[model samples]
Target chain A: MDGSLAERVDYQALVLPYARSPDQDAPRPVRHPVVIVGAGPVGLAAAIDLAQQGIRVVLLDEDDRLSTGSRAICFAKRTLEIFDRLGCGGRMVGQGITWNRGKVFFREEPVYSFDLLPEAGHRRPAFINLQQYYVEGFLLERARALPLIDLRWKNRVTGLQPQGDGVLLEIETPEGGYRLQADWLVAADGTRSPVRRAMGLESKGQTFRDRFLIADVRMDAPFPAERWFWFDPPFHPNHSVLLHQQPDGVWRIDFQLGWDADPVAERQPERVIPRVRALLGPKVRFDLEWVSVYTFSCLRMERFRHGRVLFAGDSAHGVSPFGARGANGGVQDAENLAWKLALVVQGQAPASLLDSYDAERVQAADENILNSTRSTDFITPKNEASRAFRDAALGLARDCAFARRLVNSGRLSLPSTYRDSPLNTLDAEAFDGPMQPGAPAADAPVRAGGEEGWFLAQIEHGGFTLLCFGEAAPEDLPGIGGSPLRPLLVVPAGAAPGKAAGLPVIEDAGGLLALRYDARPGTTYLLRPDQHVAARWRRFDPALVHAALARATGQG
Target chain B: MLNTELNIAAPDDFYEALVALHRDLTPEQSSLVNARLILLLANHVGDATVLRQAMAKAREGIGPAGQDATLRTTA
Candidate 1:
């Protein structure tokens, strides 16, 4: 029951407590505020978030152990920020291998090197490569620390009966079968989800014919922590290979196996060793940690929410791992759903608020699917003309910068903004800079009362924040009263000291916040609890702010 | 600068896909498929100069002269 058990425990061998209660000998129906199936990263994140909001959650998983192999390793900046908000950022960031630079190779020659993080003054890195098992381990540890989260391993939901108001679940455990009821059910049960199948729903998309052999090798080689991708390398003639450095001196090598490859033979250690040696050369000594032959697809359900039952993560949608969209997008889904579900459960927001989750995440899933499909298409062109176009782009990349821009080994995962989301209040005034309404709030360096930190961290505690820029917060703002929205004023560093801003004032040390938010003297932004910009204005208008809040919360 | 590089992302997959497209088709049918695909793609490109450069580049890779009838027609 100790909280520190997770920190010192070797997660691979960490034995989780049994799912059932010691005293319960007979099958008795139990009820929980929220029941989340699948204890993977997405479900665990949602459980943690809901528990933090004082919502009791029952998280169930069919398996008792962490995910096998280094699956879904790349954690994007947005994902890290969400993890930070959920109280596990430091551990993940400290253990993760941070890399922003990627080198795209045309055959054996390096054509372009791109920096994902072009600027500084942020808390998290552009991306980190940690094994997926570690991610689930950290989430489980955090979940165990929360008293409100009742985690049950080896508890599989075999039956689902939606009763219009709530869901009746029949769970199969190691001991015996039991019945339970939940106000809401989140099916995060992954690609071949039993929850989705039980409801007779299917994911529809294109399944790629090209298969890939993923070999995780443990080697203490001197390769830098950068993404190295090859297109028709000389050693693996005619096929492409990708290499990435993960934590604990392990490296991920992905080799494209043509459609004709025998899956069984290709997976054999004898066959895989030679191909890996071809990439690493003759003298590099390494041991294979894991090897898997996988075929990917870009698939998603028609809707993410079905009545009180919601689907998150791979259950709702799936994409190829080239862009790291699989787990990263799923985590984003958890973040987007957690707050909305919390509000709906607490009776603070109407049931319509949960509808926004369906709207927003479906759009986000579509964006991920579109990018994934494009990258897959470019990676495995369907015709000679497409190949010709791809080759032309790569060949020109050597000499021309413009052509280099066209070369996409993998676009990599970046946060998708809901620009046209129904919840976003469109800008009534013109503005500049990258951060916009419906986009995740960009982080900036700031100093508050002589303490230096980031802006996003200061306001990410629990609820919505009203950021007033370049001015002192006035007493008793119209929309601030009787709402979860708290007003925080950010003044330019050049502003006069010792001036009371009615509300809490944080100084933007170098005017970075103002510049990044494109603020003049009176620019104000309403940010959601998930750190997404809901609405903004050049000047404060109580009526507009109220309407935007209403729309963002699904009251519109 | 026009893109003249042959750095396709997955050349093996592309080759396999191309082969699959012409799997059961006769030589004449395959030729017609190629012709139709070329015309459709040319229309998509919608640039005469780029198309001409691509044609010239294609011809350059096929050897000096009298190699393919398509090259002679384009010339």
Candidate 2:
């Protein structure tokens, strides 16, 4: 079985041997520490994180080839930070399209323009709009480079059952039906997940009546790279469209289909091109790369995990693509779950730590679903009355400064905190003033402290952060426990106010700038790896904070 | 865990205040407020048998004081 001879064999013959051993006797079966179903962004992300922690992983995907469809395109700042921790941030950042602004148009006139990235912190830019396929490709490349990751393409998970202390996975490969036993299983197979169905979990939510059409095109026209939303293009009354530019010069346009149009007929170029030309104006030339028609739906699984088998990404929840939260949320789910699983598997933390995965991530999924639903509701209003109302609202906002600020800031996609989470605490007096725990302060400059960079320059450390407001010393606050929770770090607030931090910190803005930093005397805020405030306190509440940390790490 | 009363609202006062607030709000404010209200209402309606019936009555429209005359009659 030399390399050249293996390559020369009939492709079918090579696949046939593995295909014959259908019941757990295959060569590569039952050896993996963890088996992840689906090699999409979420699954690959889990593999990357776990492999980095020295755990062997087996990643399976039913597709014969890598995904080419650009299903999801938006990557938020928080998601980019996760990539940074995985050591692939530079490659992804280089390949993604940085979008900082968006334009909203009413008929022919520009009604509003929003600056999505008004502030830059220590990490990468605020957000990037890259094709989802490229992101997965980048992750796949990185995962393959790791010797611990075994990526098996064209392999489908047919049966999953809890076996012994681990789980048994029945996979259908070109060779045959093979059985695999792993310490844990992650189901990232998507909305109609076999794992979820096997566990008998039901996804409950609302399904909209309207369908949407998304097209990726290469065009010669000079359209700005900023995201553009068109409300009621003249030729197609009541229809809406969104235009976004990708890094490779491909443009993605999402059009709201008329309720009466035949989805099959409307997708034809003759019908689609006319609508696009009418909106872009008749003179511009373009080439359509891909087009897809899908009806939007929102759903969240009743539970993300059953015993040792867990679900992530679309397997756990499904959201309309309006807010670009689908893929990003899934990636976050893996990020949140991976570390906890790794700690438990390595015996650094108790098994109970894995329980917080559902507690925290389910809350996040519900939030993502709600945000996407609201964005969809606004974009594709249901009836004539709703459409009219939306139009009037946009028209009114076009002339008002307050309305313009609200519309353009895009506060919805900003990072959110789990203030009330069992893993978090609240500091009533700490995050006071206009800057609260859950939200970012508007246009707050990152100034230089005693350090070289400005405030906010310390957030790039990629671990739990303690931002001490006012003049409190970091040592005076509560100490973090060892092992699983030993990674906590503290720095001055606004270490580099205007610049992004390479590490997280605490700060002192000269005088009593406590009002600005929301600091009250001796308060502290503990931030999670994703930069969300996990816990806070007016004073050093070590007993409660320790309990929270224990609970978050599953030591409880 | 079953705090049904926590999910319940003072229909007469709350509904009236909501209508008044909706009427007085600017379009942008109204939209934002409406979105928040929808989420709040949905949270309370979770897995409740009475939710569908309540939504049906509310959809028929509310009076100036925020109470749904239809809901009052049905109740």
Candidate 3:
């Protein structure tokens, strides 16, 4: 179905066509509510998420087309959930390969294997393998569909200045340069961000003295959609290799070339084809779709927010590709910042609320960087002691179950909880479950309207929600500024209570909601617009809910 | 809770079995076997407090190294 969709179209122009903006011909600089730089995945996600909340945004991209190669291929479950809220999750999942299992091998034997999604009753898979271009192409289409997202291709941000409480940007186009003012600026530009360079800010961290050669090969080999990683296999002695299946029968194979290997020599088809041939033997046939040699560093800015300019994605932080944390974490940054930018732009929340974006996402960046660094260290094993321990673990893993826990083969990305963010209302009573305050809300099967639905869809419209269990929720919540806070009443599939005062009442399909949340009768949870738990109580109380709302919006 | 007493059911047999675990192995292989044994026993214990106590006892007389535990002394 997808193969015929883009068979003969001018793919670049069809995805994002360059057009002149009105400001280029105007005499005066115009102001927009929000302006997002870089039309990459993070920037497009931010634009779509913010525009969905009724904020007008101007999205600028320096380039005229999607990213060239299959750079980022693994999209985690959290990112898919965020994309689901944007109404395009199905398109991405339909065009991507989903996987939840992985295998790790040592020498000639399989040491350990894992299943990422062992439990049932979840809406999305643990992850999906899709090329970076397909992801950007689909996101560009989604951004174009939203009326409020003014996506300007070929508009490059050249100069930046901070005004009283806004940003003045100089954009360069084919015609000429034009000036624009924005109340808020989102820098989703990637590594080597022009915005960061323009502002003269320093990003500090350590860089690995090694290079990885990624070969995206097109083949019809019958490999399952599972991640396979090898440590010192017989084919690639004393080095590592990773294999994954992307859509269109493309296989992503990464080879670890030591620091001393000449990148120029290794990238040649003569060298790459021989290495690939050694692994697949003589029977399999393949063609190299794309190949690149790259190294990575773990770095982050001291602060993601600089006055009116907020940085997201690789602009704010970066890590090695071992954990697949780079793009996944960046997409999460968009989801974290979008709703706060919306609320602040709407005058419904204090600007101080934006500081929590730094607090939460910086913590998340630190966690990702730590994991990425540790996984790289395990994969490379820099010193004698480290190598000994790594080999010992691998040797023992073949016989003992305990050693399997010690192996580290790219700790995949998971949503980070804002455990210490100021926006959370600390639990006053004891609780025991995964839906703790500040954790991303979990998804469960539900019967909404009439058909079976998902719990996350109830708050998909970007509103603060009150999820009350086993009872009818209050009639309406007093919102701070715009729409009223929505209420969702959840009951067992067969035992729903009275209708929630004309509000939508969803039924828990198999009691997974109750089990996952550890809920009792009259339990009410305050979920933020970004679908993160802000507060919870054993029983519903209007006064307490009001306080939590204020605190969550940064009044407290 | 760490039983300092001699708790092996068969003392001579346990000593011989311990020797057999590393029999005919090189120094590096013997050390790896000992390290794996430590990890397995530590996981079997599972009490972090007990592990810490045991570590302190094991390192009682060893002086501090010239570098941090995470850093290389050669550097």
Q: Which model scores highest in lDDT?
A: 3
Which stretches in model 1 have alpha-carbon errors above 4 Å? Answer: A1-8, A22-28, A478-483, A494-502, B1-75
Task: Report the lDDT tens digits of candidate 1 across residue range A468-533.
Answer: 775565444633744578877888785753344356678898778888899987788999989999
Q: What is the DockQ of candidate 3?
A: 0.18
Once model 1 is optimally superposed onto the true structure by TM-score, how far is the C-alpha of residue A460 displaced, in angstroms?
1.0
**Per-model TM against the reference:** 0.87, 0.75, 0.91
lDDT-sorted candidate list, best first: 3, 1, 2
Q: List pairs with backbone clashes in candidate 1.
A: A391-B5, A391-B7, A391-B8, A395-B5
The better candidate by lDDT, 1 or 3, is: 3
Alpha carbon deviation, residue A489, candidate 3 (Å): 1.0
Q: What lDDT does candidate 3 reach at residue A341?
A: 91
Top-TM-score candidate index: 3
Chain A in model 2: its TM-score? 0.82
Ranking by DockQ: 3, 2, 1
Q: List the residue pairs that clash in candidate 3.
A: none
**Per-chain TM-score, chain A, candidate 1:** 0.96
Candidate 2 structure quality by residue, lDDT tens digits, B7-56: 43677887788789888677766876675455445544565556666666
Candidate 2 local Cα displacement, residue A435, angstroms = 8.2
